[model samples]
Target: MRKQLINPPQIYDGSPFGMSQAVIDRASATVYISGQVDWDANRQVSCHNVAGQLKKALANLTTVLEASGSSEESLLSLRVYVRGELGEFIGDIAPILAQYLGESRPSLTGIGVSSLAYPEILVEIEATAALK
Candidate 1:
């Protein structure tokens, strides 16, 4: 897949916090990753709190990206849904997110919702990526 990750020189980069100004995908294959939660291989929620769930969700996202032949670099955009405010947890996710995405930090949008598909789900992540 072919793509361009653009960040204007005039604007301060937001990658360290997991964000980007724009992503251009000229690839032939585009993958729309469904929202991933903290469910383990047994199909049970693995995390009870926001911090735990955040980590689990990132791990789950990695699995999906690998299965689709698209890695974090291929990611063009991400939508994060959170059940409630996670004051300190946001701080924790930043570094982990930087590590997770490596050199690529796709555009991100964080949404706060009253509830999610599952009540136990403290966080859910959906992503879009392009690949051959």
Candidate 2:
């Protein structure tokens, strides 16, 4: 399938990291969004708390989805990677997820990791969605 890369100006550019923010499969009308971290335009993790980082990451993810011609409701699955204990932050995470996803209950998975791409990053979210 032919692919199209999407890099919205609103989010941190991932090209320097050898990745695009999202890729669209023209033939299948599907979008694969790269893992979005709580990075500012300067590629710095400004949030010190998990909740704050998660909020920024989700916002970045939304920007990618929109740039890919998809919406939150079109999400097919989400893979969340957390830097620390998943249980320690579930309470802070659940509400943010609900705010972005609303009633759309797509497949979701949470994985706890020792660390993320950046030492300060607490969360990263990647998603797959059908084009709207």
- Model 1, span 1-132: residue lDDT tens: 375554434333436647443344555577666677787744488669776887888877776666566778888888888887645467766676778778888998877788997688888888888874
Global fold similarity of model 2 (TM-score): 0.95
Give me the overall lDDT of model 1. 0.71
Worst 10 contiguous positions by lDDT, candidate 1:
5-14
Best candidate, TM-score: 2
TM-scores of all candidate predictions against the true structure: 0.72, 0.95
The parts of candidate 1 lying over 4 Å away from their true place are 1-27, 86-88
Root-mean-square deviation of Cα positions for candidate 2 versus the true structure, in angstroms: 1.2
Candidate 2 residue runs with Cα over 4 Å from true position: none
Number of colliding residue pairs in model 2: 0
* Local distance difference test, candidate 2: 0.89
Candidate 2, residues 14-112, lDDT tens digits: the string is 888899999999999999999999887888887899889888998898888888889999999999899878998899898889888887788999898
